[model samples]
Target: MTTDLEFVDTQVHYWQPSANDWYPTLRSRPALYRDILPGDFPPVAGHVHVSAVTAPRAFLDETRWLDRMRHDTGLPTAIVGTIDPAASFEMIEADLLAQAESPAFRGIRVFSGLDPAADTTLELFRLLAEHDWIFDLIARLADVASYLPVIEKSPGTTFVLEHAGWPDGEEPGQFRQWREGIARLAAFENIDCKISGLGMALGTMDPQRLRPWVETCLELFGVDRCFFGSNFPVDSVAGTYAELITAYREITAPLSEGDRHKVFAANARRRYRLPG
Candidate 1:
C-alpha cells in the first residue's frame, strides 16, 4: 500500500482478561479468554501498516495498560479510558482532568447505560464537552435510539457509535432494527460511527457478507462521519486481524479513493484529533 493508504486501526484492546476483575464474565466468551498483546497483532507486513490505533476502555485500569502499550509498541496513538459517569461531578472532573494530562489520553468511554434524556447524563455530556474530549459510546443496538436525545442535547460533543451498533445482519429482524436505529442516530450531526467489531456478531470474515452493513453505515453517515476499525482481539473470536482488515478492504473496494481514505484513516485521525 502507498504511504497515504496506511491504516489507522481505531479500536484495539491490549489487556490481560484473566487479570481483569471482569474476567469471569469475559472468559465465558471463548475469544477473550487469554492475554492479547502488541505482539499478537504486529504490523501486517506490507498489506496494511497500522500507523496508529485508538483503543477503547478495557476491563481494568485501561489507561495504565494503554500507556504501557504505547510505550512498548510505539503505536496506539491515543486511548479512550473508562469513566464512571455515576461518580460525583467533582470526582469525575478531577479524574478526567488528571487523565487528560497524559499525552496518550484523548477521551473517556462509557457504556450506553445512562438514559439520554436524564438530567444526570446531560451533565456528563457537558463535562466531556468542557474537557474537549470525545465520548466513545459502547452501545448495543437497542441502546442507539436512547442516545438520540443525548446527541441532540450535547451538540458540541463528538459521540462515536462503536461497532456500528453491533448489528447481526443474518439474524431475522436484526438488520431492520439496525437500519432504523442507525439511520436515526446518523441523523445527528454530532454523531459518528465506527465500522468495527462486527465479526463478533457476524461470525464470518467474508467481505461479501458484510458489504450491506458496511455500505449502509457509509450511506447513512457518509464518508466523513464513517471510519474503519479492526476491533482487534475481540473480533478475533470470529476472525483473524488480517481477515477483518481484508474484509473491510473488500467491502470498500468499490468506493472512490478519497472516500476510501476517509473510512480507512482520515476520518479517525480528524475525529480523534490524532497527531499527523
Candidate 2:
C-alpha cells in the first residue's frame, strides 16, 4: 500500500503565547484538537506552518513562535509568515531579511479578505517580488476578484491562493463567481491554490460535503498547481487532524499516485523550496 507519494500538509496553524488562546475558540467545539501535533500526521514527510490572524502587531511574534515550534516539533519544513503589505517596503525588506536566516521562512501572508483595497497589499506584493518570496493570499470569496491586478503586476512572484480563494456556500452563483475568478487568476501561471478551509467555510465538519469545491479546485488548478492543507486548529472548529487528512485523501482519490504526491507534498516542496 506504500505509494511513492510524499505527504505534506501545506496549511496548519498554531497559537502563540501572546495571542489570546484562539486555538480554544475552535477546540471548544467537540471532536477537534484531540491529540494533534506535527507527529500526528500519519506518515507525513513534512508540513508548512501558516500564520494565524492574531493582533496585527503579533505577526512577527507568530513567526518567532513557529520558528521555536519547528525546532520543538520538528515537522514544519516551511513557514509562511505574516506581514503588513501597507508598511514601507524598506521596513518589510528589513524584517524579511532578518528572518531569512531561519530555514523554515519560505514566504509571506497577507490577510487580503480583511481589506483587499488597502494600499499595503500592493506594497506587500511588490516587496514579495523583490525578495523572491511566495505570497500566501488569504482572501474572502468576494475579495478574490480584487487581487487579480496585484497578481498580474507581480508576474515574477509566486502566489498561493489560500482555501481555493475561500469560496462560500454551494450556491450556484457563488460557485460560478469563485470558478470564474479562480480561472482568471490561474491564467497568471504564477498563482496556485490550496484545498484548505473547506469545513470552516461550510460550517460543517463533513468532508463529503466539501467534495464539489475541492473537485472544482483540482480541475481548475490541476494537481501540480494545487496543495493539501489541514487548516488545523482553526479548522479544528470543524474536524480533527485525522478527520481533515481523511477528507483530503477522499477528495483526491481519483488522481494518480504521482498527482496525489504532488498535491500532498511535491508541489508545496517545490513552491516553497522546502527541504525534501
Candidate 3:
C-alpha cells in the first residue's frame, strides 16, 4: 500500500507531560499523556509514509519553548505557535519575534474568539500578514462566519482551518451545520482546510463514516487548498497514528495521483512554507 508521495503531518503533537498547560488535561488520559517526542515516530510503514510534520500548538504562549522542540527527533517541519490576541502589541511582537528565531516556527494557531469586527482580531491578522505567518485556527464552527470579514481584510494572510473546524455532536443537524460553516469559510481563497482531528469528534477512525466530511473538504477547497494532518497523540484516542494515516489513504484512494499528492503532502508543504 506504500506510495512514493512524501508526507508532511500538519497537525502532529509532541510534548512532555511536564508541560503544565497540557498535562492537566492529558493526565486523565495516560495513554496519550505520556511523553511523545519525535523519536517515538517510526518511519514509513505500508502507505503511511511521513517525511516531515507540522506541529500544532499545545500550551498557549509557549512559542519559544515549542520552537526549541524542532531539535528533538521527529518534530514537525514547521511549528504552529499560539498567540494571545488579547495581549498588548508589545507583548505579541516580542513573542512573535522570538518565535520567528526558530526555523521551525511557521505560523500561529489561535483558539480565541475571532470577532472579525474586533480591532484586536484585525490587528492580529495584520501582524500575521506582515510577517507572512499563517493563522491556524482551531475554532468553534459557530465562529466561522465571524472570520469571513477578517479573511477578506487580510488577503495577504493565510488561514488553515484545524480539524475540519472540529465538527462534532451525534445529531445529523450538527454535521449539516458544520458543512455549511465549512462551505462559507472555504469560499474565502485565503482559507485552507486540514483534514484531521475528526477522531476527537467521533471517537473512532472509521473511514467510511469520515469519507463524506473528507470528501466535502476536498470538493470545497480543492486539492490545492486542502491538506491532511495526523493530529497525532491527541487523535491517538480514536486509533493509532498509523491507523489514522491508513484511513486517510484508503478514503482518498479513488482520487487522481496528482490530487492525492496535494492532499497528503504538497498542500501542507506549500501552506506551511516548508522546504524541500
Which candidate leads the pack in TM-score? 3
User: For candidate 3, which ten residues in a row score worst on lDDT?
Assistant: 45-54
lDDT for model 2: 0.73
> How would you encode candidate 3's per-residue C-alpha lDDT over 147-228 as one tens digit per residue?
7777788888888888888886647898889888898888888889988888888888888888888998988888889888
Question: Higher lDDT: candidate 1 or 2?
Answer: 2
Q: Compose the digit string of candidate 1's lDDT tens values, residues 65-124.
A: 566667777756777765555667676677777666667777767653456667777887
Query: Which parts of model 3 have CA positions greater than 4 angstroms off?
Result: 1-4, 18-22, 44-62, 65-67, 72-74, 113-116
Query: Would you list the rank order by lDDT, best first?
Result: 2, 3, 1
Which digits, one per residue and each the tens of the lDDT, describe model 2 over residues 135-220? 88776656657777666777878889888878777788988888887888778788899888887787765667888888888888
CA lDDT of each prediction against the hidden true structure? 0.72, 0.73, 0.72
Candidate no. 3 TM-score: 0.87
Q: Give the lowest summed-lDDT range of ten residues in model 2.
A: 17-26
- Badly placed stretches (over 4 Å) of model 2 are 1-5, 16-43, 112-120
User: TM-scores across all candidates?
Assistant: 0.86, 0.84, 0.87
Clash statistics: count for each candidate: 0, 2, 0
Q: List the residue pairs that clash in candidate 2.
A: 85-120, 86-120
What TM-score, to 2 decimals, does candidate 1 have?
A: 0.86
